[model samples]
Target chain A: MAVEPVKIKRGFQETESLKMLKESAVNVNLCYQCRKCSSGCPVADLTARDSVSDRTSAGPLDEKTGAGPDSVPEALRSGMARDSVPNSVPEALRSGMDLTPIQIIRAVRLGLEDLALNSKTIWLCTGCETCATRCPQDIDIAKVNSILRIMAYKRGIKPKLPNVAAFDRQFMANMKFFGRVYEMGLVNQLKLATRNFMQDMDLAGPMIFKGKIGFFPNFSGFLTMKKFLSRFKKARAGKN
Target chain B: MPEAIAYYPGCSLHSTAKEYDESLRAVFTKLGVELKEPEGWICCGASSAHSVDELLAAALPAQNLQLIEDMGAKEVAIPCAACFLRFKTSVYDMKQSKHLEGKVAETIGKKYGDTVTIRHPVEILEKMFANGAKNQIKKDLGKIKLACYYGCMLTRPPKVTQFDDCEDPQTMDRLLKQLGAETLVWSYKTDCCGASLALSEPDVVVKLSRDILADARACGAEAIVTACQLCQANLDTRQGQIAKKFNENFNLPILYFSQLVGLALGLEPGKLGFDKHLVDPKPLLRKYGLLL
Candidate 1:
């Protein structure tokens, strides 16, 4: 199969959001498509491209020579030890977000800020740091996703995964109001806002019985909390 | 006795994970380490704040660190993995970015010089009992099989949390071993439990946590021992729902490492807050003859 020549678009400038992500210390430009970050990602099961066939068929010798092998090496033909390679991208990835960590980084590097910011992968990311930890380039992909989320929120970009975004907003609001997470407040607000009332209702009775649910917010730290929040707002305002 | 270390339980200890707080205190006291919680400590801003506002996330935890400095404590111990990550990230940010330090100081209405060292209870217990806590062990848990789950925050993004190897951390495993519990080597030790999404996206939590539980079960672990309150809550509370959703029977009892440590230290099960867990660990404890 002959590969087609890809045309490179010229005179493209980096988006402000992309520059902001770079300034936040996420070296998106350093990702060399090694896909190590994607390979080892925990959620790669839900996010990475299904490149398993490509991986299994393209043996080490074929990959090194970039040619079809007539007589493949015995070691290479059998495919290197499976244990040495991370699990192949699972079938689950085909259903959810198509963009992997490397793909997200690639989008940012290519100045596709809108595509990166609006990606379902950004919202689904649990911030587990698996991508960041496994990134051979040491780029903090998790931090980049976080920054992209903030930018997406600031720009009023509607998240494809609204529940995830709603949860983040409700959680932050709870923190801002109580200077800590008020579980009841957060839950009630989230349920009302997202209309996800019956999702975890079964566990609530047991949780209450176990004394895990507090009836009211702890107002003891109100004063120091006020100071802390005010300063945080001032800093954010200054940044804006 | 060693000098008292400042303890910041974060919001979860005061609310949902009260058992974790009690068990941690009981275990530490038995180990002869005094814990002093600073007055009026707030939340660590958790996953929510960081996702929305980075500055708030830094400031919320910095305020607590400031309180530790105010108490003149040389070190502060955080039991919750998420809180530990927040504090560590705050200290890391303050050291790396003077701009962040100034903003944090401005927000907290106080200047913290980053003198107080942040320590996770696991790290402290690992160091304190490095020579084996056998002497402190009253009820041997040698018969109990446990899978130590580190979840996400305890050790992730090695630069932010520079405690152990990010991929396969062994701090919790080593701690469980000290308690004489048979710790199982599992693949999902550091996997995420869907965290805050536990509320917003229960299905996601169910899917992800179900995998962790199934993996532990596959390794022949009788119970899943977790260091994070969120991990414990998610894994314990969602098992039933997961069982129904996936048509699989998963009755795995998720426990805090502190609860197991308290048991080894001869603390009463009630005192350790065993009753608070959704998936009662008492049955598992009794099965292993660690409980009467």
Candidate 2:
């Protein structure tokens, strides 16, 4: 689970990517490496573990959040009330993040464009907003990740997590065509794009039997969405 | 009668999470609440638009918000937490930046102010229960130990969602308790179930989902209840794979909160779309004698 030390490419402050990131309302400079965001991030721990194939139950349970049962309201622990401290991650889950949430923020602040764009942490983020909610600086860390993802996409950085990017691309393609997500089409396209056709074939039968997968696409707003997407694309074509 | 509210099912409810669409409508009908679907509604662009282009993400939901306004309804009940978050995010972004608002207006070909209020089913139903919706319940959900999983979208980024407590939302739990079900206090309430990763990264889904389902089981929960379609689909449909991968038995049925409310209201289980769930809730419901 150890991560190699990231090489700092010197003299790259305020690169184009960093300048673009600054355009976002989020003040990346406010991040003081508080680690508060990483402390509560759910997927940060997953980055520390090996790829999915070698994963086991013991891998994720290693680094539980420091703010354990004590941070939870007394009422909630006893089942008398139903809320936990808004900022605390699960006490039993541990963190072994390769590039934790703090690191990503730091990378952005330092204009380490490559490091921030190419890290597994950005793709791993579930946009849970746990980091954003917990940050003392009021920085929307998830929004930072979102902007970084688009930047990564625009640069066509070979995704650290290709399937994740492929899925999002296929999903957007479906939205552009149908004005709605065609679940059947999206899945098939994703399978074809990722060449992962055999991955979830087992679940397909049961899903179809249960009527969970819709074979036909819904074209309710096809024309309007098509027009809207073209206009939006045309308006933003040269920018960013 | 309470004022009829607008309904935005999003795409998942029409396909993957159709049971949510069915049960929500059934429960609201039993409670004498009217639900209206906005005409020509499109997808909210879920994670895709937001991840790739901030403008399109806001614009997609902005168009739907305009439709909801055109219907003259002040509020819309979004069943999918993902859609609700997108709608809320668009409103939040537009209010925060006039430039983004102008861009979104240009993109969607519609200018919209923050005219529509977005409501989650949990919020909608809780308000009804407070106003005597409980009187309609014909049967109590006898001793069915449940964990109300409110995954990420429903209540996080408190600035945008302005929903229940971000870390530990209790609205769904309290509503179920009123229906006579035992709701457990678990720490993974607002945790991510690796949403939408089920298709892209099954390993992440299995790992994260295993943690969630295992936590519920350790807490003695016989089933898990959720208000989000992705949470339900991930936790319910991925149980067998999770069990095999983790060498654990977590055959927990992930039921939509509306399905449970429908059961409490004495609606037929068939009408609630229970059969559509991959992880069948029939045996569990039958064991509680709620299903005959």
Candidate 3:
């Protein structure tokens, strides 16, 4: 049975912070309901789709894909058989272009307020940039993903990953303060932050036997790092 | 400037991934980079414990983090994607609870100092490229086209493994650009390669592996280059099954970033450990004249 498509609601798009990010995004209206991007996508399951729920559904190359720098193989090289894949593959996909134009447009219209500060999708992107590299419009999909993330930070969507969000915040804070991520202090602080105190109960006998963990930050390395952090803090404060 | 780094080489490097370790040594030397290992290093509990028990995962790497503190290396660099994620998460978890350090001290007998940083090998390479090492790669595979695969850890859960841009990471692309290879724009870089899942649910692994290989071939990658050993193993070793299941031949070769680095460095195939791969890289090497 063909699965029915449903639209997922994103709550933060209209907010003030995302306004700037959306303005810079590319035109998403160019979508023609093509499923090549979906066909080419490796994590469609993560995004929950056979058909993209997003408004745009265009592939990267409908035209230039023939002779462009990013085009698929010429007549001869096309002879290389990838027998493992099925025969009915979509032409838009095999053309070698990512078709996430709507994302660029959406970012331009939304200003990334939602992406930066509210959406978990910002962190979910792995920078495969296949979307951009293969975009029919030659749009810079990867760069947009980056700028969206930077915007997320700008809008105070500071670190929300379940396992690593706390660490990133602390790492950034520690870096912001010390001008570097203090290895010892960071670990010690992190252990305290996570409160997984009991897991080490088993390791206590062995740790004491080995004397692996310790107290206090080492406070070594080049002293100039401290000065750098101070300046960085002041610079960021100026933005605030 | 590169921070003083505490380096972790998971068991694979000491054994199976010796090429990665050895190539890293030469690459680092060429790039003027130094990586230090903690004195009382322990296993990252591999990639399994992290998923099964987050706390245990944090504790294992925490124990090592504590050791890194003892060794006093400020920055941490991990090449293995699984280890990289494990360390990143452990420190991330430890940093959240505040009291866990003391708790860990009670259990592990040593206090973990916040003295080290964590990074992946690609980050180191990206840093070098951003700092102007692009001009150093004299040999250009200008004629070769590649599909660069990062698998899962590089781009997922962005807050912690902040090595590069996740949706379209440029680290490998930038490096490949320096080597004069055309990297395809594909969506599978951060997709799962089914790592240990191959043994547990190989059906899932095969499906995922097939998708990744198909994506690579679909984009016309003359070869697939990877940063993770498991990704290499899955994409290179499992093709026969992928072919059997999907009824197609995916004889594509998967190469390590180090092998490519060796190739660009004008090093011999023997020096690159090309022979060690279960699937021969010779067919692709022959095209590039790196093999007889």
Candidate 4:
């Protein structure tokens, strides 16, 4: 039996959020659930419960994938060779993060805003552009994830991954103040924001020993950065 | 023969990836390409600004692009892949949408004509080597096999970068082959290195980097070469963690392609910052007789 496509809500195009996404040029409707993006995405199935062998060897290939290569979905069969697709997602890495790249796009198209916004997939995205590059529809899924991240922030919906959210916030603050990234300050700020002082503390010894981490911040372009960032503040205030 | 091209090392070159800065300068100088850095170049708002405020991300790189224009250069070479992607995306976005360009100009207080072209060091080197620069190689790299890992940002999202083939980039491989190093055919060339999550969620990086390193080892590579600083750092600094977490022995030295180019050009290993690596590459270089 053929699975039916999910119906999009009426007046989706008239919504402000959809209009913003449309302006960004990401046409979610063009996606036909090809699964190419999920296949190539590094973080898509990191938290998958199935072991690599269980997923690659037994279940997906047999039960889900049907009999043989001919039984496979046409979209996947056309994109990747059968042998090359195995073991793409490794064994259990961490917990949570269920949605894949293809799933996230589907959620957005179906007007499931909260599901897409609060997904751990959006936070865990490395902005690697793998999904964007391989999409048959040419939808910039990575760009959509970035936009969703910003939207999540605007809505004050807590990020699924707090540490990743903290890191982005601190990184922006670092750029705003120093004009350039101050690794030392940024790390300290991230540590403070996340309150996970012990994490990655071991690497500090080697990093300092090799002079990889600069101890001080550079403020050479501080005034210029402050002046430049002020314009955004003014614009935001004007809009509000 | 060409006039000086603008060099934007980004923030990492000045700090965590200082060796990349040193070796890139050394190799480019050897290739007779003059690099002029724009004055007071700010951050391109790398993964952060874009993830938070789209306008801020576009504005940050616009300011730096304006500085490059002021330097009388039409092209800029960005070594860090993260910074390169941000700059290129900003330019691509502005060129595609005039509304974005107007908003960015308003935010930055300056209008950028989107005139500057962004090129990765690999692209620049590939062009140079093809154009009679191969004669500059002072020493052959012998038969040491390496995996040329492009990580994610280098040639991806072809619409923005418009560089080599995104699926299987061979520019770095072909460039290294010119100096006599064996480049392995690996499937993880454009795979993600978990760079954005390195600081936030290292367990993910460990798992991701482990697979990348394991694939390289499985393919009979003695070392890994790359053009991204974050990939180099994640692979180099996390090998022990990856080993401890996964019980796998992958001690491969992740090297910048520029460092190898400097070595092949007869520059001293110490001068190329080989000594600064967490996983020392000296023994591998010595075994291949590329270093004394």
Candidate 5:
């Protein structure tokens, strides 16, 4: 039993997500589905396969009429069947979000705000800039993804990948408290929050022995940083 | 033209990547360059900050730059690639957006004129090698093949970093070649090491780093030299896990470029802090007669 892929209406009001992407200087309209971004993406192999299988398993579509495979438009079914290897498409295109970099751009173009914001793609992005570096239209997909992450956070959307969000929150909190990232403190906080305490415990003893884990947080410029960060809060409030 | 530049040893250097900081200081000192640490510098608001709050990321590094500018230093050297990128991004963003610049200045309590230049230690070392520091190479690192891993930050989004060719950077390679080590030409030179995700998604980091290590080994590299703190830590610390997961040998020593430079300049191994690395590089160093 497979569900039909949600069909977005052809024209809709410009989405807030789309406006944010445009304001962030990402040229979402420039993407022509060249798939250059997916081809060079390092995480594409791992993420794309999962997304693609999910899409295909949800009822095969007739190529011509865009319906089910049983009542196929005949000509297009053969073509799709020929390319049904699933892994043949670029990894980014096969993503479970139904939105690789190009598809995300397209979704934004089509005003699919919730769909774009809720996708696992935003969390998985490493901000490596490989996609941006290779984008033929010179789209800064990496920056676009960053802005998306910020938007996702502001909207209070729980990330599909919880650990990454946990790490991001823990990291920022560490900086907010100590004025710098105290690794030992950060790890403890992260372990507690995520409760995966023993995940990297094997490397801990060796790291501690090597004197890499400082016992106390280095509070250099604590006062100045605290004062400075207040202004940031004010500015962010003004923006919101 | 200033003889000494301010040095910002970001949190990693103070903790996990101490060897990178120590070796950078030693190599610079040997080259007659002095590194000055600003009295009160904060974090650069690494990968985490930018994703959550844009202002915090820019303002955090802007504060450090303000401190450096206050000290009257025309330049600052950052050993960590992440810190270098943050500093560079802050300067670039401030220059582009006057509104953002004003907001950051208000936050930091100082208006940075974008005067202080942010430099990676690799850039400084490249400059030193160009300025006759090649003559100071005390020991010829004989027949030791090395893979100079630039990782992602030092050179990417070309306009921001402006360090080298974003795709196929050879700055570290050229520096190692001058140090008398055979730098291998490999495709994974600028690949992402799944930084920060080492904790959140260790599987991704392991898979990505495994490919990098396998490529280095296939390219005949005995050890991988890196300029970024995260790259060094991720590649070195995760090797045992990567090997166990993949059921393959990936015991390549991931050394900082500064450590190799320190070795070439005849600095003490103790001073270089090679003992701190999880994958002890001493065995590889001893094999190359770089250690006694």
Candidate 6:
């Protein structure tokens, strides 16, 4: 089944965010069309068509010296032996050079150019605001990249992987219906939605292993979460 | 007489992150702020819809926002950054356009009135704990330096989750102060752990997570504290694998904001879901006298 492409209009429909971004002085006109921000971007453009690099040293920055090579830190090698790389990462990008400003930015730019390829790298940005902080003219490379990632996404760039989009939806639906995230129901719905009838397959192993996934999104009553949701329905019905 | 707010908890809180849900409410109870969850609320569709369809993505959060205002709530209170950022994006869009509001409202059956407030739990927590609450903590987390990992949603897209300072948020710090934990001044508090990719792209999860862990340990933190469940899962469950695969030794623990709060509030470690984690936080809990 083909998914209808996303459509963006001149305005936002609505969102549940209360902590919206604070407005700041705009300096895009100051851009001078400078690609300095792009030049300095740590997540450089890499072609999506290229395979992932299999190198394992792309760790994040060090807290003290502030140095991490975007290498695969010690945390990524689970589930298999030391020699295996993850299925999602492109071997070229993985085995390629580290995410130096020019490298990461350039690679990402190329990868982003098509905006058809998906990788966790989009969301993988530390948002250290380093790129934003590092740009010669303060181009907000971080924000731009984030938007680009979203844009690439809006243009259909995905992670080439599964996500909690549906899980996020169901969780909110639980809150929208019950006034809180229903843990059990949420896991069940998510696994079920992803697995369809095979939902039981995903849950069976996890359930037997640790009851990790719940059948219902459980919401242990806190702060009248239940009451607030019920009242909201009544109050909402009265208005409609 | 209190102001009303809408609330949204992305999937993690419902299942893996339930402790965060429980603890956030505990903090709320102590703060005395009121939250009005919207009726017939729906999902924010985080990175999912945002990736597939902008409007479809925005509509979910829009509908939830509309319900909040329609039900008489001032705005929405989002706990998850994914939910917070996604919803806030729509709120920003609402701030910019009127037609979009009508379109989303038509689909979801709610109105995105011109005025609405979309806030994260940390924002409200900071607000409620503002008036001398920071200085009035009865408990002290003591010496246990924590790497405050904000990850992606809570910070970036500066246009969305406009909580505290985007690059360096002080809200989580304020709340941490109330909890009596010593938060390390790390640079990546607002970094992305590649959360939504945990299961789909396990490799990215491993890489991003190692960065978080490496940074935390580098900062001399005994563990990591995050507001998102995916972060918690990645740090806790995925860390072990990353360590073994990459031949890096890591014993660092991961703690939910609520678990940290539960510790400060003197709640038992067990109740905070300590046992559910693969890495042991027992020593950290012992330091706080919550483990024994």
- DockQ for every model comes to 0.35, 0.38, 0.03, 0.41, 0.33, 0.12
Q: In candidate 2, which residue ranges exceed 4 Å CA deviation? A: A1-12, A47-97, A237-240
Top-DockQ structure, candidate number:
4
Candidate 6 displacement at residue A218 in angstroms: 7.7
| Segments in model 1 whose C-alpha atoms lie over 4 Å from true places | A1-9, A47-94, B131-133
Candidate 2, after superposition: displacement of residue A6 in Å? 6.5
Q: How big is the positional error of residue A5 in model 2, measured in Å on the Cα after superposition? A: 6.0
Pairs with backbone N, CA or C atoms under 3 Å apart (clashes), candidate 4: none
User: DockQ for model 5?
Assistant: 0.33
Better of 3 and 6 by TM-score: 6
Candidate 6 regions with alpha-carbon error over 4 angstroms: A1-212, A217-240, B1-5, B33-36, B134-136, B267-271
Residue-wise C-alpha lDDT for candidate 6, range B128-206, written one tens digit per residue: 5676555445467776677888876677655445566777877777677667667888755765565654533455556
Q: Could you tell which candidate, 3 or 4, scores higher by DockQ?
A: 4
Question: Cα deviation of A179 in candidate 3 (Å)?
Answer: 35
* Per-residue lDDT of candidate 1, residues B1-292 (tens digit): 5557899988888888888899999888888778999997888878777778777778888888888898999999999888898888878877776776777777877777788888889888888778656677787886688888888898887888888988788888887787777888887788888887687656667767876776788778999988889999999999888767655567888888888888888888889988888887787788888888
C-alpha lDDT (0 to 100) for residue B216 of candidate 2:
75
Score residue A140 of candidate 5 by CA lDDT: 80
Instruction: Indicate the docking level reached by candidate 3.
Output: incorrect
Whole-model lDDT values for every prediction: 0.77, 0.80, 0.55, 0.81, 0.79, 0.55
What order do candidates take by lDDT, descending?
4, 2, 5, 1, 3, 6
Candidates 2 and 6 compared by TM-score, better number: 2
Q: Model 2 TM-score? A: 0.89
Query: What's the CA error at residue A63 for candidate 1, in Å?
Result: 41
Q: What is the interface RMSD of candidate 5, in Å?
A: 6.4
- Candidate 3 has a DockQ of 0.03
Query: Which portions of model 3 show Cα errors greater than 4 Å?
Result: A1-240, B1-5, B32-35
The DockQ-derived docking category for candidate 4 is acceptable
Candidate 5 residue-wise lDDT at A177: 88
> Which segments of model 5 are wrong by more than 4 Å?
A1-4, A9-12, A47-98
